[model samples]
Target: MYHVVIGVDDDVEHALACVQGVTNLPGDAAEKEVTLVHSFTDNPSGASATQIHSVREASEYLEDHGIDYDVNESSGDPAEVIIDFAEEEDADLIVTAGRKRSPAGKALFGSVTQSVILNTDRPVMVTGTARGSE
Candidate 1:
């Protein structure tokens, strides 16, 4: 099975965008597994991946399209947790949503998306934020 780790935050639209990216992956392969990985900087409420609104929305989208998915959650550094989870799962592709930064944003520490791309040896797909999707 081709495995993908989609790292999502609390942004619902960005989560959907990542889901769209997964669906757009080029392959006729029969078995595909999507791992919706969410990392919390700190969770006083002790939340799980499925509890996050974005993950739930993304899960719905995946379900509608007949794709198999699982939820994974971790605490502490978002990028580190995401990278660790991807490695643990032996993910074929790692997907992260665009941070929607302005042109004037910092060139360094571009958030989890940039960190994941730079650190991971596996392929990383940075899905852009939804612009005009209805």
Candidate 2:
């Protein structure tokens, strides 16, 4: 089975887009497994809400397609948390939602998706936000 890790955050629409992209991937869907992951630096309640919402949405889609999956939540930097979880899970692929950010904004605040892609050895799949959606 293929182990796929999907990173999620407070943005439900973006998270759903990630899930949708993975589900629609061209391959043997029945042989793939999904894991929805969310991270928060603090506030367990807020973290829980975000993770739950993302997981619920993803689960609805997975269940409809009879895909096996699980949910994970962590308290730390989002990029680090997601990468660590994927490593621990021995994920074959890491999927994440991308947000529209200007070069200055990305340079100033840094980007979780960029960090994950740069750090991980595994393949990364990013989906969400059309080029002009911002």
Candidate 3:
């Protein structure tokens, strides 16, 4: 049984879709424990009521799936928090939704998915299309 950790943004639908994708994997490779992690940037203004609501919605989705999971709300860089949490939990795999970025943005700010892929020892699965690309 693998411990699956998924990084969730405030978007509940996308987060749930990521969770479903991981859990729906066939055969004995299915995850036994799933953890949903949401990180807020250090900017105080970034932490809004909307984030809490999204966390609640993600929690409810886990319950609906009959899958047990822990919700983590932290303050820091998103990529760092996700990697740290996965390491702390000794997760076998990390799943996350990939945000599409503009050519300029991609050149300026490196993608979090790339960072995690390079830094983590465990497997990382990136879902969704790039920000603008479907």
Best by TM-score: 1
- lDDT against the true structure, per candidate, is 0.85, 0.81, 0.73
Candidate 3 global CA lDDT score: 0.73
Candidate number with greatest lDDT: 1
Report the C-alpha lDDT of model 3 over 27-101, residue by residue, as the tens digit.
343346778888876555666533576567656766676667777778777789889999998998898877778
Local accuracy of candidate 1 as per-residue lDDT tens digits, 1-134:
79999998999999999988888787632467899988888788887878899999999988887789989887878889889988988899999997767656746446788889889899998888764553
Candidate 3 matches the true fold with a TM-score of 0.78
Better of 1 and 2 by TM-score: 1
Query: For candidate 2, lDDT tens digit of each residue in 1-134?
Result: 78899988777687778777777777767888998887766783554633466567777777777778887877789999889999998999999988899999999999999999999999999998423211
Candidate 2 achieves a global lDDT of 0.81
Predictions: Cα RMSD each: 2.2, 3.5, 4.4
* Candidate 2 TM-score to native: 0.87
Predicted structure 1, TM vs. truth: 0.88
Worst window of 10 by summed lDDT in candidate 3: 125-134
Using lDDT, rank the candidates from best to worst: 1, 2, 3
